[model samples]
Target: MRLFAWAALAACICAAPTLAAPQISALGTPAAPTAAASDPQAAAAVRVAMRQETLPPGGSLPEHRQSGERYLYVVAGRLKVSNLVTGEEQVVEAGKMAAEQPGDWHVAVALGAQAATFYVIDRGPADGAATTAANNDGN
Candidate 1:
């Protein structure tokens, strides 16, 4: 009887359905260009770096400039980016991207009550600094 019971249990277990492997799907295609290099040749010579950044609610990055082009993709929450040069401003929401050209002075502020998380891709000269303070003297 024990042997029969053991066999029955094994058979039941073997007949059970197995779980499927996780699915893989593409997120989506890239959107229209938000920013572009002024010179393609110069952009091609830069090094690429990627990092994840987070800013708490109400936090802000003071007016500054990047040494190279910057692509910021918002993963969560929202960010308000103000272009000091063009007097343009926009709110970047989750799953959206924002780009800043080299030497474009801008300030970013975290909006809403949640912390904003994003992925930053920087393309700059191999030996160039990542960022620099912008001339706030109405330049």
Candidate 2:
């Protein structure tokens, strides 16, 4: 019985899908004119950019923020996030999404031993920086 179980486990392991390597790919960036009605003192041009980021276990982005909003879709593994502005923390698993409002500061930590990948859509001023360092308070 033990021998049979070992053989079965070996077969299962061999049949499992292999994890992919960490990588990043930029989709594209589109720009448009922003109306003064929406943002009284905003820049005339606005942009929307998309990209994918992958990280191995224990990888993390230090606390950061952007001039505009960012949306994230987790493709694999789990994302552990801590928001400094709201003092909230949560783990976003695969198949879920997380949104960060304009100028929302936060830290993201990848969870589990397996690798993780997520798609990020950033919308902001045409010339605004994609990400900026923020006060993480030692996170």
> Which has the greatest TM-score?
1
The TM-scores, one per candidate, come to 0.61, 0.60
Model 2 weakest 10-residue run by lDDT = 20-29
Task: Give the alpha-carbon lDDT of every model.
Answer: 0.62, 0.59
Give the per-residue lDDT digits (tens) of candidate 1, residues 20-86.
Answer: 2111111212233322234444434445666677899999877878765566678889998877767
Q: Over 4 Å off in model 1, which ranges?
A: 1-44, 133-139
The pairs that clash in candidate 1 are none
Tally clashing residue pairs in candidate 2.
0
lDDT of 2 at 11: 37
Compare the candidates by lDDT and give the number of the best one.
Answer: 1
The all-Cα superposition gives candidate 1 an RMSD in Å to the true structure of 17.6
